[model samples]
Target: MDRNAKFIAALKRLQGVAPIQVWPATVKSIQGTNCTVDILNTDLIDVDEVNLRADDEATEGVLIVPRVGSLVYVGAVENAVDNLFVCQVSEVDRVEVKIGNSLVTIDKDQVKAVRDKCELTLSDKATLKQDQTTIELSSGKVKINNSATSLKSVLDDLTSLLQNFTVTCAAPGSPSAPFPATITQVTQLSTKINQLLS
Candidate 1:
């Protein structure tokens, strides 16, 4: 046994161990969970569509799809044939989750939900602005505040109408005492007018 022969045998044993291979790739197209990627810096192999690895929480969480032209990691066992997978997405544009039939999307600007119904509650003040506003209520009643000027105008119009109107009545059982019966009608009208003022 020589030292050089022993070294060569050790080198051969090391070479027999399989290694993991990873390469940077660009996503070409995506269909469902399968993706086609172009491996960079390699011309020895050509890979077609590879199955994308779903995250562990994919059952109840989101599965992000790598967009075309985005970078990703392609992994394979060394010396193995036809076993390549899209390991992870190097660039993420958005994250989307599916809940029942609804889809929730989150991006840089906003978080939006596509569902049948949604409710929002604000702890602080909320301000809404528009050029014109219209509110429809189930009940057909609406209440409005009367300004002092408008109330005064209404009272003045009522007073003018009452002053110009005259009421006539027939004497009750006695033509000689007609003035007394008419005086009672006038007193009743005065009492009604007092009620309006209050």
Candidate 2:
């Protein structure tokens, strides 16, 4: 089944014995592959259930903080009026990247995946990938290919990756430099380990 349909199906399993209602939704946009679902239930529900059910491979405890976003994915039930409602919060009036960074501007549709950006931007599909890797990230898709690079190259990659952000990197006593750590280091380490194992 399509990702959205599968996500919705997974979401269905989480509805409790308590009377629950899924408000009408739309396919606002696709963030990589998985779709967003703005479920307007009577009581605000936990978002992590959707992530857990959508992909059975992962299992993590979920804690919902005010103002933080969450996801819910479900599988299919035939004759159950299954339709894809890929709606994401498309208007990100304020998006905070790192732990201590200020909010920034972005399109509302792509705001679903704007968690703490530490080199890696984790998606609802639950894939670790390079974040801010392009000017136009239509959807956050994980490309399966390991490309080797040196320290300089990695730094250059990060510089370019965060070039557009407004957060000032203040470690070097300069205003323009960005915060120093990113998921890039993890990528480099993985590449080295793979090379050794190979």
Candidate 3:
């Protein structure tokens, strides 16, 4: 009739004498790579120690950890409930991918990447765009658009010039000298700028 009914019928036909090896379940709790779930059947049955299936196999692949209260499809091998594992999930709490020495992880709040070395060689251009701002790398040069430059070297030069600012005056002491508290104010501003930017 429907997709689920058709799928179950197909499984029944294929398995013949064996019990259905797949069913929908709701995640109840998680313990490492294993989870506890309430199998959705005529009667709710709580199954424990179910493994979460991921492509990970030591060296490389992806792993997705399901969140509690998420709907998942639980599958078993050879109709054995003891071999139960989550084959699919409707929601995820975390996802991680690994390849050789590189790793990328994504969670609710942030995405992190770790690698030994990363290199990008583009024939034409490589651009990183976010919102309305863009950074482009082309022909061994970097260009930033719609964003203020916060380069430390440029800021340092401006800070140095401000610290050494002076005006020529014919009056008393020194013909060329900065205003009394200009160096202190400039130094404080430079510190704040460095704290706020790169």
* Number of the predicted model whose TM-score against the real structure is largest: 3
Off by over 4 Å in 3: 1-20, 42-44, 54-59, 117-157, 162-198
**In model 1, which residue pairs have backbone atoms overlapping below 3 Å?**
none
Per residue, candidate 2 scores C-alpha lDDT tens digits across 25-107 of: 32223342234444444342322223212233423322121123433323323313243322233333233332333222223
| 102 Cα displacement, candidate 3 (Å) | 1.2
Q: Native-vs-model 1 lDDT?
A: 0.58
After aligning candidate 3 to the native by TM-score, how far in Å is the CA of 147 from where it should be?
Answer: 25
Tens-place lDDT per residue, model 3, 50-77, is: 8775422355777788999999999887
All-Cα superposition RMSD per candidate: 17.8, 20.5, 11.1
Q: Could you arrange the candidates by TM-score from highest to lowest?
A: 3, 1, 2
Q: Against the hidden true structure, what lDDT does model 3 obtain? A: 0.71
Give the per-residue lDDT of model 1 (tens digit) for 1-198.
Answer: 899999998877876696557788888887665677888887733466566644433555566678778988887756453667777887765667777867776655555555554421112222221222211122443221122223334455557655654544556664343355455655655554454334
Q: Estimate each model's TM-score.
A: 0.39, 0.17, 0.53
